[model samples]
Target: MRGLVWDGSELALVDDLLHRPPGPGEVVVEIATAGLCHSDLNPIDGKITQEVPVVLGHEAVGRIVERGPGVRLPIGTRVVLSVFRPCGACEHCRAGRRTACRRTAEPAATPFSRDGLPVQQFVRTGAFAERTVVSQSQAIPIPEELPDAEAAMLGCATVTAFGAVEERARVRRGETVLVVGAGGIGLNVVLAARAAGAGRIIVCDRNPRKHDIAVACGATDFFVTPEASDVAKACLDTVPDGADAAFECVGRADLLNATIASLGWGGRAVIVGLPSADTELSLRIRSLFHDKALLGCRMGSVDPRTALPELARRALAGEFSLTPLVTRVAPPSEAGDLIADLRRGELERGFFDLRGV
Candidate 1:
């Protein structure tokens, strides 16, 4: 199999990558499409550390090609692969907080190998390759009506956006919402907020080119700015009394602080971006005194098994459109360039078609 491998120093396309057969409770998915996310860039750029060499991609949609014992999902069923693989025995999982499953932090068994040596999967689903194996629970089935590229996004961006707005922030009808970073996740946040019946949806991004899509995604107002302070100022300028809920989709400490500062009394700020492991945040003690909350969201606090199907249903019902959020689709050979385009804020969302890889 061919895969884009990150060998600690750089990403390279390798043709000899191999994956082991699925173990009990797992399934092998022949990846159709994989969404390139900012999270995939973290380890490559040193924003976060991971054991490498590894295949880097998690947001994927594919069809079950093989199944290990105990897996009930039939072969050829289309599904969205998720990074969140919760061990049902854990305390958090037992309490229905599957997103906080402690075992998720433990090292996952490397399924892919290069030259007979172990290669890790980014999270548990390395969908950048032609095929990848994952726990049965990590594969969430979707309707046939959902296109492969769009369904792939439900694995991460869309699920996270819906979770942030409906679960974490509990956004009420007619509330004012502010979102930072108009990339894949940010635009989805606009969609989620709009679906939550928000009165004002304000979005800020460094690229002016994203303004049109941001508005099309349901942003009532859009601001083109790069600085965190400037983004906050722009958000406040649009909603004078401060936003009722704020979501920072760009994982930067300064931006999170600005998000916190741009909230009204009793407002909630949800952190959706993944920051560097060593990054530290500075906060104004007084800013959080007005019942303001700074909430951390892990994978949008979503349980993929349940959340994905509902999102697919909503997509089928014309509740939200995923096509507009996608900026471009290319083959696995263009992974590096697409990632660079993403880092430069040049794409809203990019997908890798892995059908024949």
Candidate 2:
């Protein structure tokens, strides 16, 4: 099978990429489409450390072509991929801590190879290929009505946004919410806050071009500035008491600090962005005195196998916006190019249409 593989130094298309069949509690999915995200660049560009010769995608939607032992889903069932594979027996999984799953953090096994050598995985998933294997828990079935391109995003961006608002912040009705960085993920955060009935949703970003799109997604106001201090001030002024919840979707230390400062008394700032490895933010320690909380978000704290179906129902009901998030679709040949686009902030959300391959 053909796949985009990244060695330690460069990315290249390899036609001999191979994946083994489903083992116990695993499923093999034929890729329909896979979404390209900013985090996908982490390994290839050394933004994050990862094993080399790995397939480079996680956010995707595909149909199950085979199932391993104990798997119940029938073949041909369409599903959204969840990159995190929790070892159900571990302490974290038993407590429903999906994101903290032990297996996802530390690699356990590789399912792919080329030239009889292992091809490492990114985020416990390697969906950038024609077919890939994943734990059964990582597969979430979706309704037939969900578009393939849109459903691909459910694996990461959508789930992460939903998790950030609902799990990390517990945003409730009539509260003021602020979302920093109105990119694909940030826009979803705005929409999620709106669905939760936030009285006012303020978005901050350097690009004024994204203001309209952010507003369309649920931003009641926007702060268009590159300076974090200026953006925070705008957000604070928009909500006199301070924002009830703020999401830092830009993975920069300065923006994260700004998001934390934008909070009102007892406000929560959830870091939803993936920052560089070993990166740390310097913040005002005294800020916590207002009962303000700073928290990190992972996959929106969502259990895809359980939560995806309901989210899909809400999406199908027009409660969540997906179309606006999906800006383009490209072939796998452009996978590397899309990664470059993601780094350049030129794409909202895009997918690799692997069905043609």
Candidate 3:
């Protein structure tokens, strides 16, 4: 089988990789499409920790090729795989926390091999390969009508963006919302806020190319970060008392601090982006005095079982367009350059079209 493997040195295609069959309570998935995300570049760039020589895809949709003992799902079921590997029985999962499931963390043992040497599974679910074996719990069955490329994004971008706005920020109808960054995740935040009937949707980004979709996705106002006094006046003149909720999707401290300041007295600022492990964020000490709050949202603060279905239903209803957000659909062999473009903020979302392989 072929897969995108990273050896802690560089990321590229590995031609001679192998996939083990599913064990009990597991399923082997034939991945049809996988979305490339900024987070995927973190390990290769040493921004995040990942075991070397591991298969690195985490957001994808596939068909169930086989199932292990006690697995009830029939073969050929189309599914969206969740990046969060919740064990269902762990304390966190038991409490319905999607952050981490104790036993879901990749163990020292992995089912992959490259030229006879053991390789790790990047996030316990390595969907970069032609096929991946994962616990049955990770697969969420969706209507077969959903497109593969778009379904692949539901596992990451949509969940992170929509979920963060709807859940973390708890945005209410008639309220004002501000989103920083207009990339994949950022755009989704705009869409979700619109769906919630936000009165004003403010988006800030340095890229004007995103303005079209930012508006299409429900951005009522857009700004070019560097020049426009638009962002500064947004909290001062636009909403008067500031936006009801602000989402920081850029993962930078400076912007996050600014988002915090751009909130109203009782506004909530949700951290939807992942920053460095050691990055520190600060704001005026008095910002929190007026009932203002800053929150950390992990995996959009959603339960995959429920959130994925809701997102899928909304997509099927034509609430939003997915393919329009995609910039490219290419074979997995081009993973290197495409993924680097994502790291450099050059692409919104690109998918590895692996169905033909």
Candidate 4:
């Protein structure tokens, strides 16, 4: 197996490796494609803290080559890898909110080994290599028609955007929606809000280059913001009363504040971005008392098994263009350079293709 590994301070590729078979209630997937996301780089670059010697990857799609007991998926099934493992018996899972499961972390599970030492699996999917192991419930079957490259995105970006607008916010028709940041995740938000029937969808970003992409993804309007106050005013002007809902996808405290302020009374704000650890945002308590709600979304708050299929259906129906968001594809060895580029804001919409290994 060849995959990228991150030590506490450095990252490297380990080409000589072996992954153990799936244990009971687990499935072994031969990864065909994986999307390199900023989240993976955050930990490696020390922007986010985590354990070291970890295999870094979460958004992926692969073929199930082996299945253990209690796993219903057959060998050779195409599946999207979900990193979040929900305890089926937990209160949150029982209430149909698997993403909010009380016991979300099920670490100490090994999917990679080198020289007989187990390596940590980042986000639990560990799809940066040829094969990986995941709990049976974490593997969502994808239709055979979708390409593996596109299906890989369902694990995070697409599903997060779909679930946030549809399930978390329950965005209705005729609602005015504002999505902050026009990155890969933000573009998905734009598309999802459009599909949800938002009458006015406005996407805000500091990059002028993303304005075109944002509009193509169904943003009715785009705002380039260096001044949060001006952006808020512009968004309100576009909707007059203010946006019915705002989604913060940049994970910056300042942008979060703007998203909160841009929402109309009774409007809901969903924060889908993964912010830095221990970060905080100040708020005006009195303003929020007017029924303005701030909501935190984790991977869109929907079951991937259900949402991924629906996204695929929409894509097949020509409702969204995966190609527009795919700006770059590189081999696994370029992880270091990719991380550096992402940190420097050089990447727009992109993903790395790992099959080159």
Candidate 5:
């Protein structure tokens, strides 16, 4: 099968790979569609370093083509896989904080491909491959009615934002929220906050093209960073006491700082973006003493089995839409160029179509 491979030197399409069947507690997914996310670009460009010869897609939807021992789901079930890995026996998992599972950082215990070399899974999902193996807990069943392209996104973007707002931040109804960066994750954050009944949702990004898109995605107002004079002041003017919560989705240290500054007294700032290793962020203690909080949210703190289906139901109900964010679609061969474009701020929020293969 043809899949994108990162072998330390560069990322390229490799067809000379071999996939093995699932082992105990694992299931094999024949990927139907995979979205090219900004996170995938991080390791490719050395922004985030990983073991070489790794398959690099973390967000995707697939069909259960094969199952190993101890797995309950039937074959041919359509599913969306979660990037978060939970060890059922871990203290965190036992306490129901699977999002913060104590064993997540341990080396991946499953395998995807083997030949003269073994391939590592990026984020433990590696959905870029034609068929990948994951633990049963990673698979989330989806309704047959949902399109693969749309369902593919719910696995990552939707569930992550939903977890960030609902589980991590605990954003309350009538609270004001400001989401910085209107990319895949940021756009979802805007929508989730709205779904949670946020009173005023303000979105900030450097891209002016996203203004209409943000408002349509539930942003009450949109602000472009560079030209928006006194962004924090402007946001406070809208909420008087400032936004009750702010989310930084771009993963840049500077934007993280700015988002924290935009929060009101007793406000919470959630960092959902994955920043580069060299990136550094800081805040003043005096300001934090005013009851402000800085939080780190991972994959929206949601169980894919639950949140993915709920997000799909909401999209089907016309309450939230992911269509507006898809700015382009291309095959896996074009991935290198797509990553280059995304790095230059040329690609907008959206999915890249790789199903033609």
Candidate 6:
């Protein structure tokens, strides 16, 4: 089998990779499409450290081609692979806090190898490869009618956005929302906020080119600002008192601080982006005194078993369209350049059509 392997130094296509057969309660999926996410760039740029010789990619849709003992999902079933696979018996999972499950922090099993050396899976679902093994619980079934590229995004970006707006921020109808960054996750935050019946949705990004799509995704206003410090002012210029909720999707300390500052009294600011391991925040302590909250969101605080299916249903019903969010689709061999394009803000969202691999 062939897979995109990050070997501690660079990402390369290794055609000689070996795919380990599924063990008990596991399944092997033939990846159809995989979304290129900003999170995938963290390991490559040293923002996040990971074990080398690992397959990278967490957002993907695929079909089950092989199943191990105890697997109940039928072969040929289409599924959206989830990033979190919480152990049901863990204390957090028992308390309905699956994202905080202790097992999620443990090292995931490596089901791929090169030259007999085990290759770890990034975020436990290495969907960048032609095929990858995942625990049965991590493979959430989606309707076959959903497009592969769109379904792939539901695994991460869409879910994360919905989780931030609906679960973390608890945005209410007719409330105002401010989103920083207009990239993949940021745009989805706009869409999710709109679906939640937000009255005025404002989006801020450095890229003026993203304005059209941001508006299409339900932003009532878009602001292009070169400085992160100007975000709060721009947002307040429109809302006066400030927005009801703010989401920072760019993962920069400055942007997060600006997002917090853009919230009104009793407003909530949700951190939807993943910052570097060394990133720190500088804040005015008094800014959060007015019943304001600074919240941290992990995987949109969602349970994929229910969330993915509901998101799929909404998409199929035309409540929101995912096709507009996808800006490019290419083969896996172009993954490197595409990732760089994403890093440079040259693309809104890109995908890898792994079916040809």
Pick the lDDT winner: 6
The total of clashing pairs for model 1 equals 0
lDDT of 1 by residue, 261-323 (tens): 899999999999878888899887999999999999988897777889999999989999999
Candidate order by lDDT, highest to lowest? 6, 1, 2, 3, 4, 5
Determine the C-alpha RMSD for candidate 4 after optimal superposition of all C-alphas.
1.8
lDDT of 4 by residue, 115-192 (tens): 888787887887788788899888888888877667887788989988899988899999999999887788889988
User: lDDT tens string, model 2, 1-357?
Assistant: 998899988888788988888899999999999998888888866887687878989899999999999999999999999877777888878887777786766665889999999998778788888999988888889999999888888778888998899988999999999899988899888889999999999988898888878888988998787798887889877777788899999899988888888889999999998889788887779987799999987788867777788888899999976898888899888876787777676778888998857
Q: How high is the lDDT of residue 29 in model 1?
A: 96
Give the TM-scores of the predictions, in the order they appear: 0.97, 0.96, 0.94, 0.94, 0.92, 0.98
> How many backbone clashes does every candidate have?
0, 1, 0, 0, 2, 0
Candidate 6 TM-score to native:
0.98
Cα shift from native, residue 83, model 6 (Å)? 1.3
Clashes, model 5: 2
Ordered list by TM-score, greatest first: 6, 1, 2, 4, 3, 5
Q: Report how far off residue 75 is in candidate 2 (Å).
A: 1.0
Query: What lDDT score goes with residue 223 in model 1?
Result: 87
lDDT of 2: 0.86
lDDT of 6 by residue, 192-256 (tens): 99999999999999999889999999999999989998899999999999999999998899999
Spell out the clash pairs found in candidate 5.
163-300, 164-300
Q: How many pairs in model 2 have backbone atoms within 3 A of each other, for residues 3 or more apart or on separate chains, i.e. clashes?
A: 1
Model 4 clash pairs are none
**lDDT by residue for model 3 (1-357), tens:** 888888888777877888777888889999999988777777877887777888988899999999999898899999899866676776888787756565655463577887788888877788889988888888998888788888998988998888788888889999999999888899888888988899999999878877888898889888888633446565556777898999988888888887887888899999988877888976678977889989988788888878888899998998877767788888988887787777666777888987766
Residue 298, model 1: Cα distance from true site in angstroms: 0.6
1-357, model 5: which lDDT tens digit per residue? 777888888888887766777888889888888887888877767887788889889788888989999999999999988887688897878777777786765677547565767888898888887888888888888888777777888888888888899888889999999998888888889989998999999988888877887888898988787743456765877777888888889887777777777888889999899888788777677767778889887788765666788888888887877776666666777887777776666555545454535
